[model samples]
Target: MESRKLQIRDLTLRDGQQSLFATRLKQEEIDKLLPYYENAGFYIMEVWGGAVPDSVMRYLDESPWNRLRTISKAMKGKSLLSALSRGRNLFGYVPYPDSVLEGFYKEAIANGLNVMRIFDALNDIDNVKESIRLINQLGGIADGAVCYTVDPKEEHTDTTVKKGFFGRLFGKKDEIVEPKKIFTDEYFVEKAKQMEDLGAKIITLKDMAGLVNPSRAASIISKLKSTLKVPVDFHTHCTPGYGLASSLMAIIHGVDILDTNIWWFGGGSAAPALELIYVFANKLGIEVEVNMEAVGRIRKELRTVREELHAFDLVKNFPKEFDPLTDTLPAEIDALFDKAIEAAKADNEAELLDACHAIEDYFGFPKPNLLVKEAEVPGGMYSNMVAQLKALQAEDLLDDAMRLIPKVRRDAGLVPLVTPTSQIVGSQAVSVALDRKKGNPDYSNPSNQFISLVKGEYGHTPVAVDPEFRAKITGSPEEKAYDVSKYKKPENPVLPEYGGVKLAANDEEYLLLELLPSVANGFLKRRRAEEWEAANAAKKAEEAAANAAAEAEKADDEPITGEVVTAQILPGTVIEVNVKPGDKVNKGDVLLVYEAMKMENNVEAGHDATVKRVFVKPGDIFAPEAVLVEFE
Candidate 1:
């Protein structure tokens, strides 16, 4: 009997880029890669949204809208394009009101988004219900996710909780830790069924951490196929190095689609190698169709992309000797699987988990990571924590932070390691460890974001938060679930300008900017200015680059005619201004005070400088990039 054909989905432009390059693969890089992806036989290409948009604005200093539109036009329906919908949160952590959600979805669809792969961090079906319904209402495919995790048995949960480097600092490690609710096959199947009922055209088994075993994956897929009427897709990472196995088992049990990336950026924390999987499936007599020529060309081209961005790409840490021509899984990988399974079957979960940890350690991982299966911290959270600590120059505290994560998460109600929840728990874990190191008394108090999460402001968690634990963080165990529609509506979308030159000329552009005004506006301003520089250059491109370089070096002390360092507040009300134009100030001195969310924030100078300009006066309400002070 013939096997059912498998549909391949490429995530190279989205998750793959984010995984390998920290999503620094610029729009131009994607543009160069797009023609190749267009012919790559992907069921759909994930080209926009997810971390890409956030990274574009924050790190790349580019317009995410431009990225999506450019790729969308290039693909020209050769394949459907999808994006990650963080449900109520969109790209940010806040659970924005439905009106804001509408703006995000509507604008994305209008700009050529075809699929809404929506998933809530907690697997809260309630949080995704509106998005699922809205995706169909707006003529987009709804792909709902059943995020994968292995809920350790009650007896085994204790083994998962470990201490960071500051293990001895946690003297308050509660002795009577309560058992977390065990997630069962039923839970996964039920979630899939709910997605099916909510108009999801596809159900995605999202194994972000690659913690799902072949046996468990088969069970979930079998149960989901029997229960749901929609096609089932699977998404996983190669970080744990077991993705190929889990994917094969999933396909055998009836997953209709699998997410992958080109070989060049395919492994590590990224997706399964699309080339490897295609060859493997075809060799196994599994029905699949692929164009080796197109894939090879793309792979060759990606090698160039990798080299061009070699400093940023982490794929070098992955297997170096992979040959895509012969669809083969390396014997080393097979050997690792043997060791991992043997560990899983050992006398205790600790032995099994240790073996798994040993395998991860065997692989030289350069990026952020906490791969202990017992802890089940998602890859994104682990990487994000590492990045955060590195930025703070305290990366030595990573091990301490890693060990602290499980404890902090459990204390905060064992919230699932997914989006806002992952970020919330992760940030708090860092805080706890940092406080412990500093002997700060408020080490246990979670930040406002974590407190809001405990209040049920984000949405329902898998299990009710522990009352005693809740009281420790927020002074009460009361969970704060709210009707998102009733939450304060986001302020009106506003336009950005420079010297009265309005940047967003249309409502669509304005709405896109509204998602992240300050970052997006600054990015657009810089990007457009660079383009203008390039186009109007009377000298060679190298000279223009050199001129920009020269200006950057003398930027702070010798700037005039609007080309000065500026600080602006977003969604803020300026209540105080500390200086006017031409005033001298010292480094770290506050230039002004603005209030956002009732919290006063100060704009400070990074270096001692004379004020070149003051863009705002006291009592002015301004959006992002409304300069507070320009430095000489």
Candidate 2:
């Protein structure tokens, strides 16, 4: 044992809520726990960043800036306040201009943000270089994260390559083969040193998927501690049951800080529980002085708050009627699963096991996801793919999509799957699977984001993308380098009164508006209207009723057209419309692009047709299954 003090960086407010409840934990719900967390003796409390900035405004109608300020005030300088930033991307999926980065960091530090854990999805030093510089210049600790991913020991070869009779006889059959090891321990060590060179105050090994095993964690942490002058922090999740063990190894190897959460919300897909780690560290003769009593109080209160947010809870959403031991196995229940015989007849073992896990999760049993471990994917990535497929109404294509993800990842130069990139790759994989199922050629109908990724727009992938594939995706034989300086500035929709709604009374509000325009716009408008209505009660009441009637009438008149094309999954803002009324289109041509789930989804034409009427334009928000275009 190293016998050094192991500091705990608490992630309950940000990643804990994000991992467990879809980041829908309200600011008021968080306000109740701040006092306890203040006394909890945590080294750092992560309260902002990740999906929090967007989720709070989009779902809870709360300002992310206000939440940060409130928590900082409540903490009273007891614990360091931290937020996660996605390098040049900030909180959004796409990279913004330098002005956006500068402004966002300035406001974040001014709001009492002590630390900014900055990372690039692809681990590109170029992408994060400016973010590290900006945060340090703003007097906030920039904890640079080397996003973690690993190559599989082997990969199953594609069966399509072994086609004809002679080819079948002479060609290598589809079989498992060793993958060239690219992300070795040395690769991580070099990346950490590069961040240190760039003036990162600390280096963090961010295993977003819990893919790092105990031994691997030990090797990397030890190497980082030895090679780097800055302190090393370990951040991992318990999605695949590796968080506790790997985090313990990190502590044993003299990791300066480790991330954890409350016991209840700590383990599945989140970090290890602070209480458990405190006890284990002490048992191993390491000093980790966390306030157990405060932790207990926070846990007690959070459990109650969790019940109030049951609608967003994954565990709570499982069917309550299933009882495998007593109730008949063939009983029909929720559509999430089928009766026993039908399920067995269809050979839907994956769905059956998922139902069992859901039941176990509902009953408060230990629900570990072995699929993530077996597949060697981070739990979040796996779940994101499944959700994407479900939303596309291609649930049956889940296996095809899942199998295609690794290849898609490899084809894109083996970029580490983290937020934005994980989402990008997963979305692309689903799109590819859907296209292939529809009899399109391989690599046909690639998303614009996917094309950008291959063309090196998101910075250099781990391994360079093959030149031929790059040409196919980019429509040019020669690869073109992307320059951030030349990138277009994001639209500033923070007018005093835009779309007949008040927005941006202050710089903080303006920052929110600029960072996430659509989400912030919707929330800010409602917030301003509520404030106005509170002051002018009688007049607003009458207007509210009239508006309600108008909304109801609009709801009844859903968009109708001959061969209407609809958004089949979720509501999103139309980011781009590539076609106009009366424009001719071919099968697989991207009609319009929408922003949803932090991804720019390209809606493609299903068949050759002419555009009769384009129902939406850029900046228009559409609902699930809303008709987007009409064809004749």
Candidate 3:
């Protein structure tokens, strides 16, 4: 085993909160944990970036920049603070101009970020170089991440096509396949060298899927440590339970740092718990000193905090009830994970990989999560899809959607599923499933995102995208790679004061508003008008409680006499009418189907009820709270 000391980075505030709470954690919520994190003696704390600003304005109605400032103040230089950046793209999907990059980083660096970890979804070195140069120019530690993805092919000799059943159906092999993504040691070494040459101080192996096996982790980490001069760190989700083993193996193979979180915010799509690794570290004879007592106290407090966040999500949509305090997983589940980490500590790579696979099979809680590797859904998109399906009252469609995802992904040139790509591919899958339900599957045409990708908006795909697909979408053969200087200088986002709200007082606030103007103004306007925000909060609280109670009652199989599918918020087009007057339907039988966002959604009988009337017919479009069927 490598004798080097292990450095641990805590991701509870960023990836952890994002994985478990849908990034709903606001500045105030994050504040309470900073002191403990500082005391816990981590090498770095991931406090800002990665869906934070977007989610802040979109969902939490808070300023992400201010959160960083507050966190920096709370740390008081006790620990290095890091933020995730999307290379040339920054936080937004489309590549911003060089001018925009400079402007954004000026505020970001000044706001107290010590380390900037930049990554591109496609592993395009072109996308990573400018960001590395800028962070170095600013004199901040620029950490470049090699976003990890792998092919399902067992070996180079295994020349099998990836799309299988779906590919043959759509004739998709002409588009793309998985062999190119088969991440070997050479791949990691190459990416790491590119970053190092660009003056990166650190290189992060970003395994967002938590799919890296211990043997693979050891091989890659060993190769990088031998080949590169810079330190290496591993970042992954605990969603599929493979992270702990992979992290342990990486550490044994001379990894400088690992990303983890507290137990409450760890596991189930989050990072591996620091406590679990503390166990592995002790066994491996690697000393990692931390305030265990303080960590325990913080975890206890955050358990309640997490529940409150869970209630917020559960009340609003189809989010499953989460309890950080309860280990509701089967005993075998914990055993499987413990075994994996143990094997890693013992340097038993085969056992560790087996344990990792076993743990992966356990993630979906009563259901097998084998689909994660197959579907390649990022954790963020996974949580979003769960709630979206619930809001549409179409949880039954989830499995169907998951099955259709591979084809949707392959059809889009098999772009690595991360961030913006994940959402784009995920939505397309939903469209495919819904469109197919209407018996007209659209495969030739691609979504706007796929087209934009073909046009080189987000950067290059790792595998060669289908030329025909590109031509069909972009009206061109293939998008030629371009320099960052080619794009026009983009205008600063417009910021306007609303309802006597205060305008930005400084560059930091202006950047926040610029990042998301409407969300910032909405929050700032309400921050000034306490009365308005309070009243709105109260109204939402009532709605949440009522929805919770209705859900609870629905679970008990109550006779739901009135069924309103659309909530009067989103208009729906009646696509299929499954029931008519005097028709008897079972509790789970579909009564009607409506089309929205190009997907078919169903209104089902909550309890077996006789249809008294059908309110809408095929081709009828109606607003929310539209009565689809009346039951007697």
Candidate 4:
């Protein structure tokens, strides 16, 4: 597969002139701009519109028709001079008939326009066909521009027309359903095919609002180029960050021509400049036929224009700073903008504007040339500022104190005085230290000195001072010599009484628990009772099993001393005993039953052993160590 080479069309003289105020260039300026574009290899130049001679002539001292003839004669070679015309309003404010459009087209061709770009805000196919027919009659290449600015609501649908007819015939009420208005790939494809059929040599997708995204551009351009036999071109503005993305996608999807500015004149609100396209095209292996050196020259010239215009305060009214050399904006400039933003958040407008001015001055312009116009801080910064303001208000230094003292405190390793004990003393100490550091006079009385010592030292650290001593010093009105007797010091005062021990059993621990009193009264009572019962039951059962085993062992050692050993009770045989320690038994009585697996055996006393004891009964299960019986 062979790769297609992309071509650049400079719209700076046309589009750039439109964006500027009334400062139109003279014929000399236009002549100078031509060589720059020619050197940049832009052969297709759109000079002026033909429909409105009066308005177009307002910018040039020479008539627009005569100027085009002169430019065409001066600029030799295969360079084509083109003019833009509309079937209706050529001046963008008034509407004219198709005959008027035809006459204007003929006159522009006669005056030396080799190409005609017929455009309309609304996609009226009849007007497009009439214009294309006129251009074909005059032996000039016609380019069809489909403007996307037409209100989608005005889009007509066959289904809607059919429904309206059916409703009117049936005497039904008029249905208020809105017509389908979404511009789809199918719609653009159809429009492209229609333009091609109307003898349009080229079809352009004119994106007025810069709303086209990359994915949409790729899909639409791919479909249009594949469906339409003519070459497809893209013209768009830079808005909402889609300009560069849309351009790249269009190129990848097979767009033949791209409209761009030489420097800062042609982009959207923040679109990539022409230099970016050249750089990107090289990296992507696409052969761009634009002269890079010429583009750089244009950029410097644009900067000169921006500086001259800003000198007159014309550029200052713009909301954002405009940079002609998009590639040269240093990363440090962004950091400076951030600093300016922070300074602005502190309500230092002078500092904020100063920072803004630095950026403007660096770019060789005034304010309102950058992308972001306003400085905004996050909620956290705002909250901190509010808190600092509150503190300043409380200290009654709201007039002279810095608005952002906490930021200074954090940077300086100064802790905030939160507690009342600390607030009274620590605040005074910090104030005195700050004032002294600033070379301010500090007048501390004896009472104020005592308060500072008590709170600043003891209130904030581990050392414990007697509260009574603090009271004596702070409360004394006479300001006389210190009375050591008034201050009662502890004999064996534990350091825990001060701030050493974090958890004091009776003070800190109990006090915290008291603060968050339990709300689950019934649940707590039941849980405690259940835990106690389970513990007691387990203890009693363990002790009883031990006692029973000990007595059973004693009985087994006696070995039928007072009674005959029953033959039914053999060693290693399992049995169930019914008595323990002191039970009476009669002669020839069965004392216990023994079982192995499911089979049962009985043990009968040969002679009455005075019937000492039985330990196991019905439902009583035991291991080998578990006692069954004990004899006296």
- Give per-residue CA lDDT, model 3, range 157-204, as digits (tens): 234565667775785445445444445779778989999999999999
Clashing pairs in 3: 239-269, 568-624, 568-625
Pick by TM-score: which candidate is best?
2
- Candidate 2: Cα lDDT at 452: 86
Candidate 3 Cα errors over 4 Å, as ranges: 1-3, 152-182, 312-342, 345-350, 353-368, 382-411, 432-445, 480-505, 524-632
State the lDDT at 195 in candidate 3.
Answer: 94
TM-score of each: 0.71, 0.73, 0.69, 0.45
Write down the lDDT that model 3 would get: 0.72
- After aligning candidate 3 to the native by TM-score, how far in Å is the CA of 543 from where it should be? 41
How far is 298's C-alpha from truth in model 4 (Å)?
Answer: 3.3
Candidate 2, residues 1-632, lDDT tens digits: the string is 45578778899899988988899898888989988988989989999999999998887878788899999999999999999988988987777788889999999999989999999998999889999999999899999999999884344545334446776677666633355689999999999999999999989999999888777887899899999999899999878766766776677678999999876567777887775566446555778857777877887788788788788776563223322223432233333233322332343444434543443354353567788887777777788888878787889988787778788898888988887778788888888898889999777878888888998878888998889888888876555556657766435444444334447666787788777888887787777777666757867888897996786577447555569799968899999999987999999999999999888899999999998777777998999998888897
- In terms of lDDT, which candidate is stronger, 2 or 3? 2
lDDT head-to-head 3 vs 4, winner: 3
- The lDDT leader among the candidates is 2
Which candidate, 1 or 3, would have the higher TM-score against the true structure? 1
lDDT of 4 by residue, 131-247 (tens): 788888887888887754211222233334434665657633444455444356676677678888989998888664555655667778888888888888887655434565567
* Model 4 misplaced regions, further than 4 Å: 1-3, 21-23, 50-56, 59-62, 92-99, 150-179, 269-272, 306-632
lDDT of each: 0.72, 0.79, 0.72, 0.52
Q: Is candidate 2 or candidate 3 better by TM-score?
A: 2
lDDT of 1: 0.72
